[model samples]
Target: MDDTEPVRAEDGCRLWTDDTGHGKPLILCHGGPGLWDMFGAVATVLSARMRVIRWDQRGCGRSERREAEDRELAVLQWSADFADPATARGYAEQLADPWFGINYECNAAITAEERQVWRETELVTACRGLAVPTLIVDGAQDIRPRWAVDSLQEALPSATRVVLPHAGHVPWLEAPDEFRTAVVNFLCPA
Candidate 1:
């Protein structure tokens, strides 16, 4: 186990990160704004050498829940608030609710009222360029839709992306070998 700390953003928002000092801060932003714990096997392997931070966003997993007033959510809101016009909405809406009925989906039952609130959110703006090298992995077949891949490329000019073609929404499951290779390379460079 490592130290978990809360970070205050410029807007007075609180976000948490696990700092293990494995290497540099390799923040792992899980897919679902609701699907919090999506990555594991790879994270376990990476944690052995780098400070991998997996945040549960504002409303899913264990990080924090949406306040009454902030009950709504958006794909952009979930994707670090990227306001860049060049950034693609790609599979944003499509991947938003793939596993809705599954027990794993978070906020699936948001009331009709909450849905309205979620509409108000304007998304934060693409993550302020990461300071350290970043690796973003998307499933080859990831309901990811074609445009989304293009948008991802636009967001992080320096980030490297790996798509597991045979894989679907979850690459770790479909293409474990390729996924593992991508994971290991990102965490421990040659």
Candidate 2:
């Protein structure tokens, strides 16, 4: 599984996927809700001890959705104004140009429902019965508020949190070596 593979879903979306190494399955979810898989370097490091399954989420990266789907998303979600006019214009152009393949609707549709469910249900409480070693890595300057990360740390069992001080949402891009070191140390501590 050294090469990139395209997988077709039942709904006609073709996801670009890749797999490497051979150990416990580690599914790496890309950070940007709409961005592609940008974890190749991290994959190289972690593959030493784990089977890394990285894939571009639907309607992003190499997984292009149909024109109709893209149009629908643009119409439903691209009605808001952005902070910067140039940025807004650029993104608006990208939305109209089917090449960017951004799934605006899907990205905008995600709510705090998942987190709310985790908090409201017995899932967090039931986690008391589990004993899994978890490594939570986040950028200190991430758009996700500190309280959100703290809440996750509090909810999970045996979880260690690492915040890359100089990074934003994508720590690997901001601090590659540090990101690699932290992940390697966590997965294969010596």
Candidate 3:
């Protein structure tokens, strides 16, 4: 946080929750389906304005790492990339399977066969059913040529998308003030 030190969670989840001002229940899902123990200063600022709920999506940081297969099923983890938002896209395509030719920002080295089967995964379905007033934030620069943020917004109708320019991968980390402003706007939305 920009003001205070890191606050650890005791639920075996490496999440930091605080009732900043009793506003909307804002659950901050950082980017990177693989990152857990990181947050940008922007959250620290937003912490003052609303009830901020941020968590490590279960693989990165303190969350116990899962089997490679199970990890692949963790679609919620993708939202953790707030710390490393990107403007470009297509990370999964290049490294993706030749069949579907799916490229992702974070593509773990798997056999070509694995890539083919991975495309049929129901991970997105699980992610789609998440019951939360979620806000998907992304960096202006993503590895995939076409940013997943738009697709994410369309898929998750309840979720809104926010893109920060001059910020890649992690908006809060790259441009603290701008990220903070966005967070405030999303939280306040006046």
Candidate 4:
């Protein structure tokens, strides 16, 4: 796992991937389904001690597009990638044309045959073990359901939650001044 390799998926999509460094495996899945392996900076920092594996998902970057059959199954996740409708237009305008594809970032979760494995992974238990100060800045108008955020707030006992009244998911883009002030205040309290 020291060099980049060209791999082919069972569905026949050609993938470009690589594995480097040593120690715990850290797979940095990019955000958008359309986004490619543009995490060089992140890999550079983590590769010092981590075994980082990166790949361009199907139909993105250098990977070949999915076959017709697989494309049918991919339609839903591809469409639901950005559930926030309010920011969809603005976000699309910000992106270039080559960045639209199926991001299989959560393939394990989405394509798993059994739910018990994921269910048994107690994320809350892991979060409870944290010993450092934590801040969760959320938007009051975020597309993500409130219950989801509430669950995280409940799980993280030491995390302070800041909900900007008029902001959405990308609060910095929506309200830069307020977002900056909140972050600065939290990071460098007076």
Greater TM-score among 1 and 2 belongs to 2
Tens digits of per-residue lDDT for model 4, 1-190: 4768879887666898877889999987766656799987887788889899988877677777654424543443333333356654554444323445455567666667446544524777877778677888877877678888888777787888888887766666666688888889889999
Q: How close is candidate 1 to the true structure, as a TM-score?
A: 0.36
Best candidate, TM-score-wise? 4
Model 2 Cα lDDT, one tens digit per residue, 51-142: 99999887778776677666655643542323233344444455476556665477655655655555544866776555898888787866
Candidates arranged by TM-score, highest first: 4, 2, 1, 3
Across 1-190, the per-residue lDDT of candidate 3 in tens digits comes to: 2222334546443333333434666766768656663554656677677756665656555455434424344322333333342512333222222334224433555556567665533646756787676777677764444445666666564786777765655566566687788788878989
lDDT of all predictions: 0.57, 0.72, 0.54, 0.70
TM-score of each: 0.36, 0.43, 0.35, 0.47
Runs in model 1 deviating more than 4 A are 1-124
104: Cα error in model 4, Å:
2.6
Per-model root-mean-square deviation over C-alphas: 22.1, 22.1, 21.9, 18.1
Superior by TM-score: candidate 1 or candidate 3: 1
**Which pairs of residues clash in candidate 2, taking residues 3 or more apart in a chain or in different chains?**
none
The better-scoring model by lDDT among 1 and 3 is: 1
Clashes of each: 14, 0, 37, 1
Write the residue-wise lDDT of candidate 1 on 2-97 in tens digits.
766766656555665555547776877778536675555667778888876776676566555544213235455433322222332433344455
Best by lDDT: 2
Clashes of 4: 1
